[model samples]
Target: MTTNILINRRSIQILRILVSGIFLVAGLNHLLNVEKTAQRIEQANFKGIAYFFGEPQWLIILSGIVMLSAGFLFLIGYKTKWAAIILMAVLIPITLTVQVGQITSLGPLFKNIAILGGLLFFILNDTEKKLI
Candidate 1:
């Protein structure tokens, strides 16, 4: 029984780390390409959301910072449950408002949906046990 519990704990830790790593890498990419990302945000044209963050360079920078911070927290498994939830909250708007009709490739569209599903899984599986 003790060995089984130990194995389960280790499995959960690994899963958490893997999930966090994905966000961390994606966040870093966003931070690295702020200008391009901002342009994408502008293209999104999400009414007030774009206007608020598009014109001001500082707001763009701030958004990158927030994404990086939240992603890092998630990757390190520090408040991972909340971090995943925050990520989902931040991503859903962009997905709906920006990528909804613009996706020209089926691969990318499926990828986006897969990412959302993964986020939902993380949110729903916020428990003491490992899924894998």
Candidate 2:
């Protein structure tokens, strides 16, 4: 008789770290392509804080840095709650202002929602560190 094992705690933590790596890569891409990211911001019409930042490009770059640092912190299990919160600060606005357009835009919207769920998981649980 054999029994199938579902996810153990180690597996969950590994999954969490792997997921965070995706944000790390995405954030790096944003920082690397500041011009393109700025163009996207302009196309999205997300200019509520343009006046405060003097340029939407700066805001975009700032968000990219936040995401990059947050992903690293989360992966390393250092101040993870704070990292998740900071990442959410960037994500929520972009999701609402940028992705919340038509109903057909469910793909990216749901993807972000799932990522938010993962961050919340990290926020609620203090998993043991493996590679930290």
Candidate 3:
């Protein structure tokens, strides 16, 4: 006997919400803790990337804004592909600058990888009718 669980639209939307929630919360934290988060970025293995972008605090704030807005869009199933692309753009540098090359960050690194996989789902298969 084989059990095949059919995934439905509601299931996918729930997964989308679950995936976007992390980015939404993280974005809020970035904006709320700009100084502290910037300091952490300054101490990361690739602080130069942050500096190259601009002031670490400003970068944090900018990324926070992007993540928060795009994450909300992603959660609400509107322009999901674009939102996922935007999020993946923000996530890559963060994962590289903060999580990579750190022994203690393996768990978070893999978590981001999993999140990437989830976002990739939207980017690859989001075929809902567009509103704009």
Candidate 4:
């Protein structure tokens, strides 16, 4: 029983770290591609959502802020369930708007789907535990 408990704790720790790391890396990418990301957002043709978000500069910064917050929450396991859900909410719209119909190759498409799947798993697990 003790051994099982230890393993479960380790597993949770690993999952927490992995999920947090992914968010951190994604946040960094947004920072790195600020201009390009902003451009993409502008091109999303959300019928004014982009304008409301305020040009590429402000929008990119906002995205970075959101990602960083979510990443930090995940890292510290603070409100992790809500953090995961928020991250998924943000990622899904971004993915659908930006990557939809542009997947000429299977690799990128599968990668995005896999990330979504992982986020869903996190959300479901968190929900089941009432962690949020």
Candidate 5:
């Protein structure tokens, strides 16, 4: 029983770290490469939404802030549900703008879908019990 519990704890910890890592890295990229990221956003199929938010650079900075903050919270298993919710909120528009409607981007689209599933897991379940 103890061994099983240990395994489950480790599994959840690993999963949490992996899930949060993607956002952390992406957040850093947006923060560090605002112009390039903005250019990518501008070139996306649904870039109008990016413009709707404001200048693409500003949007990218906002996104980076949200992702870094929420990603850290999620990684540390603090306020995880809210963190997941925030991440999902940011991800939908990004997925739609950059990944959707492009045949070549199917892989990234599916990857984002899977990431959504991971975030949904945190939102729907109290993983805190198993996390510690």
Candidate 6:
């Protein structure tokens, strides 16, 4: 007997779109609501987090733009590895600086890290594997 449980290239492409679309939407949402973004960061309960980021509200909007743009690249299959790297670049620092102090209690931190992990898998694999 034989089994075929794996997906093919087109399926992978759609999956990639779906994955990257998540970041794109999130970033766009953040940008559209800078005040809410700033408030959430402020709610981090880490005063130094804002001070460390410098110009917190502005930085929030900037990063939102970054994530949106990077997601677009990844979605369109342009410079894919680089796009993943860019997303990670934005993700890791924000993860560490903004959430590290309260990581143990923050669900969002884990979700962000998991997304980063997915992006890493998307970048490092043999270009034909599927990751959850």
Candidate 4 clash pair list: none
Off by over 4 Å in 2: 1-7, 45-54, 102-104, 128-132
TM-score of each: 0.67, 0.77, 0.89, 0.70, 0.89, 0.75
Q: Name the runs in model 3 displaced over 4 angstroms.
A: 1-7, 127-132
- Each model's C-alpha lDDT? 0.63, 0.73, 0.88, 0.68, 0.88, 0.77
lDDT of candidate 1 over 27-79, digit per residue (tens): 67667876777677667635356564456345446555666787787667677
Q: In candidate 3, what are the lDDT values of residues 1-132, reduced to their tens digit?
A: 665445577778888999999999999999999989988897888887778778888889999999999999999988999999999999998988888877876999999999999999889774474322
Report the C-alpha lDDT of model 5 over 10-59, residue by residue, as the tens digit.
77778889999999999999999999998888778888877877888888
* Per-residue lDDT value at 47 in model 4: 20
Off by over 4 Å in 5: 1-7, 130-132
Worst 10-residue lDDT window, candidate 1: 1-10
> Which pairs of residues have clashing backbones in candidate 6?
none
Better by lDDT, candidate 6 or 2: 6
Clashing pairs in 2: none
Of models 4 and 5, which has the larger lDDT?
Answer: 5
Count residue pairs with overlapping backbones in model 5: 0
lDDT per residue (tens digit) for residues 1-132 in model 6: 655455477866886687797779878987899888777677665646566768877787888898899999889877777888888887876777657778566887887887888788678754544433
Candidate that beats the other on TM-score, 2 or 6, i.e. the better one: 2
- Supply candidate 6's per-residue lDDT for 102: 81
The alpha-carbon root-mean-square deviation between model 4 and the true structure, to one decimal in Å, is 5.5
Model 6 misplaced regions, further than 4 Å: 1-7, 97-106, 126-132
Q: What is candidate 6's CA lDDT for residue 68?
A: 94
Model 2 Cα lDDT, one tens digit per residue, 1-132:
665344476666686688688679878987899888766656554445444446766776787788889889888877877887887777887776556663666798888899888877767655544423
